[model samples]
Target: MNHQTTTIDLIRHGEPEGGPKFRGSQDDPLSVLGWQQMRSAIQDEDQWDVIVTSPLLRCIEFATEVAKQRNVPLHVEDRLREVNFGAWEGKTTAEVIAAEGNKLSRFWEDPVANTPPGGETIIDFNQRVVEGWQHWRDQLAGQRALVVCHGGVIRMILADVMGIPLQKSFGAVSVPFACRSRIRVDQSDFGTLTSLHSHG
Candidate 1:
């Protein structure tokens, strides 16, 4: 088979209206700054064949706007949503430490072995995100695509593409709000991650 290349732009959704907290599974919409951030991040990109986004409001809202403005097809993927933080949802780190203590710390340090109470396990979350990545990678082969997703999801995808171990994936790279990453998918279905950019 001839080699085909697919270019995918992974964009983390802008800041949510809610202040810093475990936003996993939280449906907060984008704040004013969030809208500005997404708008700015995409300003440089001229076009895309398709736009995909997490089902969460934080990602989908801006993705919908972009899809409409750019006249691109939009797809909502639940697997791309942020890992559900369970009881930690909407709680700050201090509060979580006061509540779960070592378990939360363990989760922070070694996500694969440690899991937050009532939250999705890192292994499961990685599998889910991988499925989404594979689906899109195959579908968008030989085309340029954009995905609006969460920081965790973006990190997971990047780790998979770069062969980074799951334990080191969480902080291996920083995926700031409205950050954009580029990935190239070759004909063999392997992904190579390149470029880290943020909106001004």
Candidate 2:
């Protein structure tokens, strides 16, 4: 039996205009440095056959540029957007800590259990991301693809692909700005994390 393989590279958007904060669903554009960081991350790599990105401006803007430069197909996937933080949207860590006390820490410890008030639950977020990932994986099978998305989105997909417990995903994976992770899936739908890179 011949086994088909699919390659995917997941890249998190860099710093946004508001700097570091709970940027979920905020739709902020990338900062100047964010653009530089993203460019630097992919400067040496342009082997993708297609580029998929979140609907958010931060991911789409850069994805668009790269797709055009590489002359590849570009897709904007809504499910690839970051988790919605609801009441915590657009707030800094210090602000959230001051307002909600240890809730932030607890949420970090186990996002599946301690959801931010009014935020999207980890279960729901994971489901959507997995669905989106499956769609892309199947749609672009046997091709190398790049997914430009948010940190939370990448973490959830990575957890699903690698069998990392959803509760432990936050602590197990660290997806900083412009970080890139590669996944290769075989004909049996088994995925392996091939490599992970963090760009400065």
Candidate of highest TM-score: 2
Off-target runs (Cα >4 Å) in candidate 2 are 188-200
Q: Scored by CA lDDT, what does every candidate get?
A: 0.84, 0.88
lDDT (Cα, tens digit) per residue for candidate 1, span 1-200 = 45676778899988888766889998999999988988888765457999999999999988898899888899999889899989999998889999886877677668888777788988999999999999988788789899999999988998888788999778577888888888876664354434333321
Q: If scored against the real structure, what TM-score would every candidate get?
A: 0.89, 0.92
Give the range where candidate 1 is weakest over 10 consecutive residues by summed lDDT.
191-200
Whole-structure CA lDDT of model 2? 0.88
Give the alpha carbon lDDT tens digit for every residue of 52-171 in model 2: 999999999999999998899999999998999989999999999999999999998999999999999999999999999989988998899999999899888878777889999888
Pairs of residues clashing in candidate 2: none
Q: Estimate the overall C-alpha local distance difference test score of candidate 1.
A: 0.84
lDDT of 1 at 189: 39
How displaced is residue 115 in candidate 1, in Å? 0.5
